[model samples]
Target: MRRARVGIDVGGTFTDFVLSNGADGSLTYFKEPSVPSDPSLAVERGMAALLDRARLEPGDVELVVHGTTLGLNAIIQRRGAAMALVVSRGNRDVLEIARCRMPSSYDFSAPKEEPLVPRDLVFEIGARSAFDGTILARPPVEEIAELAETLKSRGVAAVAVMLLNAYVDPTLETEVADALASRLPGVLVSRSSQVWPEIREYERALVAGLNAYIHPLLERYYATLTRRMGELGVAAPLYITASNGGALSVDSARARPIDTVLSGPASGVVAAARIALLTGRQEIITFDMGGTSSDFAVSKGGEPEYTTRTDVGEFPLILPVVNVSSIGAGGGSIVRVDKHGVLKVGPESAGADPGPASYRRGGTEAAITDCYVAAGIIDPDAFLGGRMKLDRAAASGALERVAQRLGMTGEDRAAQAAEAALSVTTAKMATELFKGLAQRGLDPRGFALIPFGGAGPTHANLLAEEARLAAIIVPPGPGTFCALGAIMADVKRDYVRTVRRRLSDDGAPQALAATIAGLEREATDWVGSEGAIVEATQLSAEADMRYAGQAYELHVAIPAALGKTMAAREVGELFHQAHERLYGFRDVDSAIEVVTLRVRVVGRVPPIAIPELDKTATAVEPKGRRRVFHRGQWLDVPVFLRDRLVQGQGFAGPALVEQEDTTTWIIPGWHARVDAVGNLHVSRG
Candidate 1:
């Protein structure tokens, strides 16, 4: 009669589920092949299978936290609802002029990104606001009525309102949006300030526009999912994971779908951080390699790094999100020889439908997964715990084609091609990892790589060796780690306000305190409204500070205790210290300008206790041996069943630890040990 909390993550190829028992804290993991046409179908199918496997009924579930890439895929594929933008007069070119920066500096032929809303679809309004929160202009109701009629005629399913200086005072813009919504019965309406009330008009407008663009698609998906869940007899409250490494109520997510766009990867990073803290690792890099791409996120001191600036497809996103960078190819990334006779891994993926040639779907091209099968790293009959059988001949045939394209004539040409392709992929990932760490002034040698996703553990050792990383921590059930993360996430949200004023100003101290206090009130109110999901609440604050005349500002954290009581001088000192730490110098003599204030609220959830694995005094033996192609030679490698390995067990490479979800490859130069929590700690000799 123990209640279960299910965490689900919908991926490109599979839908992952993690069921945590409320009474004993034991966990169960399951993965189902994704339904590309309707992702909710996979969730429904997976949930039923998982409940049956665990001998639990749907009514026994207490909560369900879910994360999806539906909104993200819609935006990336340009398949979201047809949306129109309503902006202040003379600001019709906001998205068009988008910082006026070209995507590539070296490629002159690079085309600019297509704006979400076309120029023809963008309507102008007289509503405008001044920086001081004063209404400069307001459009007549008749004008708004006419605009709504025009939008309806144009067949836009949704509309976004973003007037000039709407961030300062959202009232006028909200009124305009409300007016439009009243006229347009079925169209969804969104206003800039309600979405993200930052100072930048372009960024604010994009936030609202992006929210509206994906709102209809998500609404339909959520509705279908809710109905399906009910049909399955589950009455638990549903929570959706957010981009900021947190969870939001389904209602909240429906209102602001943009916040959930990056939730998929963010969930993995969140779980990685939790694992880092539990393992006492101070610095770690999370490497998530799924079907479509490989992503890397850095965590320090048990917390994942977060950024206010990131790219969503071709658009710039200013929303604060767990900082995750897409590094290189993944399992289904195509392997090909370019016309110049140079081998390339991918920027194009085969995805789930065709998947890899090994899946025996319709794909005829060689992919990374096919290379694994061709290279003997993956056992064709043992894949997915024998749930699905892979075709080794089809995989080899695909690689053979690529080998022929490379003009290789040996009988082992396919194996050679796979080894070469993996080498290319590893090199690309290592280079990108180094570049990302270098930008943050971090050393690759200082961090342990924690890899998850279906293919992450399978490729971790190769990446670590190429990057010269000291170690890797392969967590238990790596494939379903993101789903586990969804269960561990707390209810969280961020609030921001732009208050551009120099600390030297007479009223700056009171203004800063007042702005922070107001944001805190809003944050607390939001957390309170999240219902029984929150066990306790915490608040943190930060300010965007810069020297007067500086083009950019640095985000400086203000201590929670001093948030309301800190004077202007103390705040300036904190900024100076932060600047010194980051840039190695402080412009102490310069006047400090506070451009924006940010507040983050976190609602704590009861932690799930993962039981430790049983220990054994006897040395573990290999389950079998597999012939693997390594460094141009085929070698017989010992393979261990991951489930049979006991805690405190130690082993050396070259070896393969096979499990239901993934396989861990320990190269010849490394050693591995199992921790109490069943995580494999692999390190160089």
Candidate 2:
């Protein structure tokens, strides 16, 4: 009897599942058209179908890992619970007064994202604390009870508690939360300190409120998922991918669903890192081009970069998550020429139902996928292994319409028009990639591009060329890589605390000791809840510090044991050196202020190594030849079967490497070789 591990990833256009046999290390993938109206239907139906295809009993499954985009979609679409906010008195409009800075300076027509919590639902109580952590005022017991009753009577779905200086001391905050829970048994209650114990009242409040807004929706979905898994008799503990490029237990995930909003794309980045390490590559960029959107992430040394202040839809989250950036360009992204004679690819998508014109499901507009078929890069007869036939004529006709607008003729001009449309989309992605990397001082030439999604490999080479990247690594089963990532994520969580102090021991001894102690206590509690997954936890501590009177702060990593032996003058010298390395200058004569402290609590999951490929004496052969449009001409290209390619097998350019799940095209002057882990490594001569 063999046990199985199941991983499921739900996308806007398709739901994919991967079931790997724990006994044999054998893998199987299944794809089903996603039902966007009710994503869970696709999950349930897809799971059953995948189990049947793998010839495995659902009872034999030992673990089930899932990655979803439901909360993210809900926030983006502005579809979630009606929530109320509870703020310290005199700060009734903290949300409305966010940052007070416009997103765009040039476009006056551009509007700011609407706050998730409206003005009427915002209630204030008399709770106040000074920046120095001194209590200024506190609400009476009767007043808090009345406020709770008022919130319940107003029919608010959830409540958010955000008080000034709550991060310094959460005792009063917890007292209020207890009162709310007792008064309104069903209404969800959250405190900003419990969610993110960091400074900046507006940002911290938003995190808790956003969690409350998406709470019920995610709770229901998780309940259904758990029940469905149980009905199938799989009793193993379930894990869900988090935006931090790690997994969390079901209970923890349910409590902090906001942390999982961006998990899906992050998973692909994680999988890319794993694949890169197997191929002995250190610098890599992951390109995930799905149906409705495409995303990219940069990894160095097999670790994804993390950002603490990334946006979730229109809101900002104060937790650390893998930095995966997305743009509106994918296979299902609609393309049309504007009345101004300019071609536009997407900010709008045909989505799954009316998916590209090539899908032949009532769509009439051109899309990037349609261009792939028109340019002959995708075989019309072998789409999804012939499971679905694309209407090439429809795709060509749609391109012709755009071509006519540009006054062109012949298939050559039509293909050029299609490529032009794709060029615009690709250039948009490249520009975004450049800007993001520039912020971190990273270069594209130092990174290998790994593409995975419906059209990831198809577009990887083009994007890499534009970005001037050195190489490309197309992994096995590219389209289902996100599911593969979910299966690979480890259980983890993040912790932080705000400490305003000078680095000198005499000036900030009490503050430094208290902050470190508080962070350790929080990290210990979180890691303990993770059970055996955290056999030995790793803790990384850093301080957000700046020169006195400086508005912005720079994060500086500090030794975790600094509290015991480090002298005040020694710690001050450390800050000066760290500041010089980051900003090119240090303020030796100026005073330093510690704004905040952060700790990352990581729980290690058992490593899942890439399975070794069988190196038998069999030569991988091309299925056939097809004319592919490239470099202003059509050339007959050899399309080889990916699964048949053995380890150490090398091939040259002008070839299409086809697999059951994806296609990788090796351009002219490029060579590809199969590694022991069965990844296609493409590099220029």
Candidate 3:
């Protein structure tokens, strides 16, 4: 009767589950086709299958960590509940006039980003606050009641109240929001200051609006998920993964669903970061290729980079999140010929409903996965442990349409087209990876590619070669790594406040101390609530600082001891050091200023160590051989079963290693060997 800890990640095409038993340290993986109409249904199904496969009772589950892209999809697809924005009288167009700049300054023809709240739905109240935390005016009780009536008449499902300058002091904003919520009854009302408390009016408003937009949808989802788990005879605590590469309690997530918008991608990056720290591979790139898209995160010195200025679609999100850049297309990305007969892969996906042509689920379009099958990268019959056999003929037929459109005729036309589509996909991925690294001045050759997800390992070698990288690491159970990451994530939350003042200012140090103290106090209480299930906690603090008169600021790590009243001179030095690392040089003589303060608190979760495989006495035998198209010719490549290989067993190039979840291709002129952790490492010959 071993209690199991489970992690489930719901993706566009599949819901993945990873089960870990602490008693024997055994881990099992499972995948189920996703149900787009109800993602939770897929999760429940997958969890049931995983538990049964592991021979564990539902009652034996201790904790369940889950991640999903529902919130992000809602935002991107603009399908969230209708929400109204309540702003100060003069700022009704805050979202419309965002930043006063186009994404492309020179392209006047560029389309403007769609506003989260329609202008007609925006309501302006008489509440007002000065920039210095002084309440200049308050909304009249009669006026508020009228506004509530208007919102009710409009049938807005949620309301976001953002009074001007309320970030400086949330007292009035909280009162107004509370009053409105009471009047609205069932409609959710969120205050900008309560959601983020950041200085920028527009960003803070977006945060509140996003929370309100997703609140009801996430609430219903959690209610169903909870009922399903309860009916399964499991009483385990549930945690939802957050965008900051951590897990928060389900209650916290329901209240702030916006924080979990990037949950699916963040979990995989967190897992890679943990592995990097443990294996001492400090400088590694995590490449996660799932069904809809491929994303990669750079981890250096055992930590993934964090950003506060990332974008979700065209909308800017001013919250700290693990920076993951979308680099490549995914398996279900459609492959087609444009009007000019130019072959193209996708930014659009087939998703789970029809999936790829090979899925035989009413899909008519050929996708990247179909290319993998036509080109011999993935075995059609062996996919998903043979539980769901792929339609190889159907895949070829779909691809043949594209080939005929290209004016080609022959048995090799389909293979040629598939290879060409794959090349286009890989080339695009390589280019994005190079450019993303260029932003940080990182060299691809200096880093190893650690690829996970169903398609990452399958395409890693090609990407590495195209990007001119030296090596690749394919971890075991790559397809389910996101779930593993969800399980590995610690309980966490982030806090930020604006303190726009120069260190050289007469009273800046005391103000800094007060602001830092206030933020730390809030962080302590917040993390405490989120980490109620954990035993210990970890905390880190950073200040966004810049040289006086600089347009942008850099985040500088602050010592915990400096929380009370850090010496202004020492703080300046830390800023200089951070600047030197980021830029090629730092000006020691420049006056420094601190713009914002950020605090991250993590509740430490018990780590699950990777159990080593038994040492092998001889090289593992190949399961069979297959004709794989490579460099314009078909070659018979050795195919090996991944489970047969133990630690220290070595293999050569021109090989295909097949597992239940994914396939790893070892290209010519390279060699691969299994490490102690059962990871397949491929490097140049």
Query: Highest TM-score: which candidate?
Result: 1
User: Candidate 3 — what's its lDDT?
Assistant: 0.88
Listed in order, each prediction's TM-score against the native is: 0.99, 0.95, 0.98
When summed lDDT is taken over every stretch of 10 residues in candidate 2, the lowest stretch is: 563-572
494-586: candidate 1 lDDT, tens digit per residue: 999998989899878888888999999999999999879799999999999999999888999999777886588889899999999998999
**Candidate 3 Cα deviation (angstroms), residue 649:** 0.9
Better model by lDDT, 1 or 2?
1
- Candidate order by TM-score, decreasing, is 1, 3, 2
Local lDDT at 218 for model 2: 91
- Residue 253, model 2: lDDT of 86
- Residue-level lDDT tens digits of model 2 in 464-578: 8888889999988898999989887777777788877776537476667676677777877887886554456777777777888998787666786774443456667778888
lDDT of each: 0.92, 0.83, 0.88
Residue pairs clashing, model 1: none
Better of 1 and 2 by TM-score: 1
Q: Is candidate 2 or candidate 3 better by TM-score?
A: 3
| RMSD to native, candidate 3 | 1.5
